[model samples]
Target: MVEAVFQILRAGKSLELIMSSYELLNEIEKRFPRIYVSESSGNGSPELVVIEEAWLPFMVSLDVMSSEKETNRRKLRGLFDPNGFHELITGLAEMAYKTNSQRLDTKVCVFIPLSLTLQPASKTTLLQFLGNMLLFQYLVNVLEGDFLARISMYKESMNWNFLRECLINMLLASKRVNYRVLMKECLHTICGLYQDYAGIRNEPDSSDEHSSENHNTDVAIALLEVQRTTCMAMQKLIIMIMEIDMSKQQANMLGLTTRSDGLRIPLIEIILDELTYYRKILPRFLQIFNDPKWKLEIIVQYLLKYTAKPVRTRRSNGPSEDSTFLGVLKSFSDSSSAYMSLTSQQQLPGMPGCNEAVIDSLSLVEISKNVAAAFNSLREADKKIQISSLGKEALFTATMIISTS
Candidate 1:
């Protein structure tokens, strides 16, 4: 029944059918959850109960993927295998990029060829795009439901197995999925949609040649709402993956993770690498990837990559005081002595001391400028962002340093 509803959304036959099926699927999932907590008969304690036979939107298991017939059946039934999931996000990312670049008409049908279409191409395109958006939205909803239930159980049991076996983990672990490419696509899709809806990028031009103005206006409004929600759903998916990574790290620390848990690059590191390579997305990513703890950590790490010394002693287990945000702010002092204090050990032979001093001064100036720009970006991205105590101190330090400089 759920798969039938999903098929309706995938078919993109009509707006009314898509909306109704989407709502019905969500309601059904809510009422018949696959995982939940139930009280144990013996100890009156709550135990995590997973209905093994319950329907899931994902078909990520190796056994299922290994059988061609079974995989085909699942695909026919509208289940998202890992490969299909990656392809879906990848397609969305491409669509978003094209839309942002003004190369792709958002109201033109992407799935159906114009020559073979029975209906008006523009209207078909609009409905198809809306369907894809809702499809991704629903998938994210399912993932969130499943992950949150597992996380709740994990908190009580400290069981790595529960998370290790989650649909998301299983999906990412599949050999058919290119984890890095998938993650990069997700980041692209989120930032592209965010830029479009946030007015940073121009809206796509409307096509009235193939559809009526009234129809276009209605589709435009619907697209706007669904696009915003789709962006939020993408953000939620990223955060959930990061949460799972954090839990896996905790499990490893406790020696609860075994070889069967398998190894995967942490999502935070993947995001950081992507942001580093695609510098244009860094500010937007920092703004929208708003899990405060992770956001702060990413910002600090990003700064340290540019400002900190190239190497640290083996005995140093963590970033030293000089490598911290406060330390970076302090380095912005106008005094050459303050600058020299941070880099004196790296002085080279055959280089004049004055030349070295000039280079270090320029470096300090650049770092300070970057720090200021990053803070400004954060503020621009979110006007209501609350600065923590440490953030406030760092801000104050930067202010004083700027005044003096």
Candidate 2:
């Protein structure tokens, strides 16, 4: 069914085929099916009824549908509803987390191929949903370059929250949707920007291709400055999923712990790959997030847990053959031993006792261990060409404690 629709859309014909598919799925089935669940009290299980078959292809078609019609700026303006696309993106990771509550132990990410056809959308909301998800494709690509503040209208429409919401969803769903292709492109772009930053920021012997790529020093600086902050905040957002797992004790306050067994391995891999690959710029950029206002401990803990194991990229056909960041990720992942040797962790004064304390204490130790490992990785990785050279000085005081120990 999808193949036929894709062919029609690909041919640049009218959206007749796609619309017919939507209407067919939209039709209600007459037969009522029953489902049952056993009650814990030993009473008879309750039977549940669903109105529609919830054809998933209908939902997947929305992406292509919107892309076909979203040529005008005004067409997408109506998507900014109070309880709509914004929340969908920001809350998707958490939702995926809960939906697979029983399966997190297996390292299965709750994020799945979204089936939007099941949503109870009014005609108004349906259009909004289509336009919004399509817009996500452009926004993710935009962040890869210096397009943020270039246009006055873009400045008015997009803010930190907006970007954060979309990117978070994109990261989780990149393996499933149109987001995958574009995000891979965005990663490539960000990697190049990091390369330019590296060559220009360092003294001679840094490759000419790097510094020469962005001949305008001021533009390169501007791009990295914004890119760093965005990436740090994005990292914090990704780390929060793991933090949500660790904070299962406070499910009521955060309203995010319905299923907190743990983060899935795939999600962890995605986060680790980005964080590891961008270690070139992240350590310096991370200072913005280190302000006491944010939860730096969780960020540190996330790094330790995911990067603890070496990144093993399976050989594949296309771009995987020579990605610059893949080598760095593998190197960082292999340094787990250097990270595990920290013997003691400093206790924070006046800390509360409870689940919060457990998470924080674990966080402190993880933070301590990662800091120590980086310094060690640096001293050694300098001799080896693969380790990132960005963050050695970022953890000066923390590394000192390990050295003295």
Candidate 3:
């Protein structure tokens, strides 16, 4: 019955049916959670109880993904395995990228092969897009529910096992998924959809042949709402994964993790790597990934990577002594001779002999200017993003140095 409703929602044949099925699935999840806590009789503590046999929206294991019968069942039931989820996110990312490039044409139907045989290629394309959006939203909803339950249990029990077995963790841990690519695609999808939907809402509709169809209009209206929610869901998923990484690190520090658990690179590192390579998306990503703690950390780390002096020893695991945001900003106010001595030894990648040129180009003034620009971008991205006292001090210091420079 759950699978049937999921299929109906994925089919997206009727908006009414889509809403009803979507709501029904959510209600079902709420009433019958797969993970919860039961009060213990002995110590008055809450015991985590995972219903192993309970139905899940994901198929994370390799055996289940490999089996012919299981594969056929997934196809029939619209279940999302890791590979399928990756494909879904990839598709959304591509669609969003195209839209961002202003190459998405509603008049020309780009058909995605699906079971639904809706008439008119354009309508079919729209419906397929809507279906994918709805599907992603539902999956995020499931992940959120499961994660919240597990994290709650972990808080009470301090048991890393419960979180390690979470659906989001398992989904990302699967060998079939490229964790970095998945995160990059997710970042792209969030930024693209955010811009695309905002433009759609702000711009006036240009009348076209398709605009006359009330059915198409209705789908467009629904699509707008779903896409907005989908953008939020993408952000939520990224933030949740970051939360999981933090929790995992905590567990590792406590010696609760094992080798069998395998190693996954922290999501923050991946995000930082992506932003460094694709600086064009940095502002958008910072704007969207608006968790105050992580956001400040990312910004500080990003600045430190360029400004801080290189470490001489591989044994040192901590950040450089001068890596703090305030220190980096203060470095901008130092004498040119002192600043040059501080950063002249560091070499930019692919430019071994140009350390002086690199330092000259990326001068303290230039760094301070960019720092102020980044803060402005953050404020522009989110008017309500809370700047911590440290953040305010850093910003003030950057702007003051910039003015002096």
Candidate 4:
């Protein structure tokens, strides 16, 4: 029966045949109906034999019905055919949900290959559903389950491209969903993988020279390229989100409430944290900053914006809150002492301009004035800022904490 169904499917039979096959399978129980069962030939009457029919359901699942291949092909001519690939996904999802199963059975998953589907389009329910389904958390769940072992088989079989593509998909999904924590974890994993590859290359007495070199150089380069691109993508996303956050603040300044999580962690603060994370390897990030395509100047503009006076919340109760931005300014001034100490005779790329940028961007004197003004302006709502005013004393003792390196 399975052979017959396969023959029909290969032959490209009619739609009616396919529908009938599907309906018939739906009516059948788990056990297959045997056609003929024969025993010893001499004495017993001919017995009907029945075999378990895997193909009936499988073919039906494929939605192939007819023996006439041409008719079926004609019936399924268009991409929008009623029994299109999407319906298969819909059916699979439904079955999986009904069965209380998260893992698609191997046979069922094979029947509906993920590669055959299209990514859902923007602003659509399907897109949202697909995005949620393929989020980093979801992939992490898959990784922690049986899928990890199966994924290893693909890698072991030298299917690195597919694995890489899958990883890329996971990264993109993370960005689309704004799953920051998960995205960071994935980035860390990629970095760890690169470091491990490098360590293997640096190992002593390794015989597989070509493999070690390839792993350390080629694989590491590819990984770094992806990581850089992903980081830039995240930066751009954050910038756009920051713009929205800025607009909200402007509105709020005019007495409107803006509900945004962007305020929870400013983009500049995040970048600063990222930079600090690898401060010991400053050369790497500095190299990245020097890259021609990164638009470091534009990034510098945003960083300057973050240096603006920190506005005191209406709920603040002390001087400390009022001087928050001043404290930051003090820190900046302290750092800039290295620049101040250097003579005009010193020449370096971007260094000469740094002093002017800092002065024009947000002068130390102006920041100090803002701190004083903030305190005078403070009402009961800004008591925190008032309390933080003692931070102003740090300015008088400013000095650079320079490293000889």
Candidate 5:
């Protein structure tokens, strides 16, 4: 039956053929199902379940893939048909339940294509492939409970390929499919990949199958797209994290924001590391900045964050925190050309303006105010005036201008 399904799928080219194949499979399963009813000692006719587990994976895959051309193969325009994927996964899950198997089998795994149809040989596809494998591992194994929903986005790593394909498809689509939700799904996947890979390496000294350049430049680029996509998703998640009222659980998911509730914030460390990478690929980032309204404010927000809660280097004559605040600040200050380009560019289409207003509205000004508060808190404790000044003169000048205005 499975072989028949596969043969028919390969032969068919149109929507009708695909529909027919699925109908055939449904009919076959109803009649045979590779089982039998046997009479027993009790209760009328005892139903003896003869479960045919052999080549189960192949059969299940055939049942799904045969019904939909887009399900198993990549489309021409470099986007994926997500409905195809939906059918495939749904078929696998249904088959697993019917067969009473605890987990999906390798045969089901074997049908997963080597290359998806979208954007042949592009770097985007490479990352999507990696995202899919890692996401599958997490979904089928780790975080299989309530914690799973917390990381519901973990499933997205697999779908990045699909979303990329979908994006391409929409561009050529006769009628476009809104990909905002799809983009968000892909970004979630990318974040998950970053969390996984970043989690695996605890120290800078660790070695792996891929070179650091490959991981950072190649793999990281893919994840970065996910980050970029999130920005495209209208910064919905980003805005949520920035909200002062954000709950502890929500803060954890928005990995780049500062978390006051935790003993330590993981997101800040992640941003620091990401910024370090950005510094390495400064030229590339400069290029992205040139593309459009890349939301320089989000980048600026991240840069300014370290100024407030600078990472304290763990001493051991060991790993030094290295005052990354200065590093980030310097990067921003150094990018005079990029900033000028940004200021002059026509505010690239997708991103809305007024981000400048948002940045001005943030706590950047409060840093100096905090200094006064800190000074007052310490003045009485020590019974001595602790005098330290650096940016104070600049702040004073700025205050004067503000007061006059």
Candidate 6:
């Protein structure tokens, strides 16, 4: 029966063929589950007993392609309608969770296409792949009494429910000692897919229709699109973080493994390291944006979120933080003697935690000329790109302006 399922899946192309194969597997699963009634134990009583994981080997072989570029091999895409895929994943999750099967993730992760791991991922594939993983994660989480209701409350979109929540939940669950490595591998694989997708978008396409210079602009636009997708997803997750009012629990996801709540925050270093690679490629990617100022401003806005608690600044009789920041940097650079003093002090020499703001009586940004001049000075001296002038100034100015009012 398993051999028949694999053969049908490998050769299946039409929706009818795929659904037939799905039905076959469903029937087989029904007949011989992880725990099933056995023949009578000679005393006319039926035996109900646990069995070895007999389903995993067939699932592992349910590849879209048995070999590379196999003409007959195709994805189960047509069969992956909302209800059908959900049923399939739920079955697999239940079976694997029950038997505690080894390499079960490998079996499940194969549901994501091998093409996703390649370059130039389509939006269709990405969402479908994400949907499938979340489905599997939901099934597993459903068994945990703690997560059951929250998992149920998360509404489904695109036939996949709260992706941000599910992804984080799965990662948090994986952090457990038993499932850690398997879960990590699955995450690393998914990240690798996106990296490939992003990497492909960052490159200039050699198009016959466009000149070489124009092609660079095209690549920049494409890179921006890819960046937007990732950044939007991140923003959604951040909003989800803010929404979580975890006022109670024996522990509100801040557990023994690490002080960091894996559920609340993603592996940021992993993400940032990938972004650093994106940053290295960004200079080329930024060559031909229509609104260069807005591009620079947006990037600065994202990176400026380092301030843990935003504080309003009281009036200072002395020079503003923005004006003094460069002096502090200069002194720190020219004098190795100030290194310890600079870092040790709660405040840096000339710069305050809150920066300086120049505002109108009406509290409007009416200091364009002065601001531009200051910006130029900062830009010229900030060759190392150690800090963003706009970010620092905005932080300082906004806080102070609010305080003064």
lDDT of 6: 0.34
- Candidate 1 lDDT for residue 186: 94
lDDT of 4 at 394: 36
Per-residue lDDT tens digits for candidate 5, residues 1-405, read 554563443344433454465456445555554433445568554443445462121212211234356633433222223343333333322221222111111111111122332222333333333333322222222112212222232232322222212212222121222233333333333343333333323223323433443423334333333334322222332222222122333434655333223232223233334544445433233333332333343454343333322234456465222223223343233334224322342322121122334335445444344334333443443455445453466447546554554
TM-scores of the models, in the order given: 0.74, 0.29, 0.74, 0.25, 0.22, 0.28
Model 4 bad stretches (over 4 Å): 1-228, 259-263, 289-405
Report the backbone clash tally of model 4.
33
Candidate 1, 1-405: lDDT as tens digits: 777777888895778888888889889889998887888999998888888898888887743445688767877888888888998998788767765222223342223233334544476676777788889999998888889878888888999888988888888888888888899899999987777666522544456664453454555556667778899899899888888988998899999999877798877777766876789998677666767666765665555444434345788796344444544444433234234433454422111011223334555445555456555555554567676775677666766666677
- Predicted candidate 6 versus true structure: per-residue lDDT over 201-255, tens digit per residue: 5455434444333413332333334333433333333223222322111134333
Which residue runs does candidate 3 get wrong by more than 4 Å? 62-67, 100-121, 205-215, 310-321, 332-405
**Model 3 TM:** 0.74
Ten contiguous residues minimizing lDDT sum, candidate 3: 347-356
lDDT of residue 214 for candidate 6: 41
Task: List ranges where model 6 is wrong by over 4 Å.
Answer: 1-174, 177-371, 382-405
> For candidate 2, what is the TM-score?
0.29
Q: What is each predicted model's overall lDDT from 0 to 1?
A: 0.70, 0.33, 0.71, 0.33, 0.33, 0.34
Instruction: Supply candidate 3's per-residue lDDT for 325.
Output: 50
Q: In candidate 3, what are the lDDT values of residues 158-182, reduced to their tens digit?
A: 8998898888988888888898899
Minimum summed lDDT over a 10-residue window in model 6 is located at: 100-109
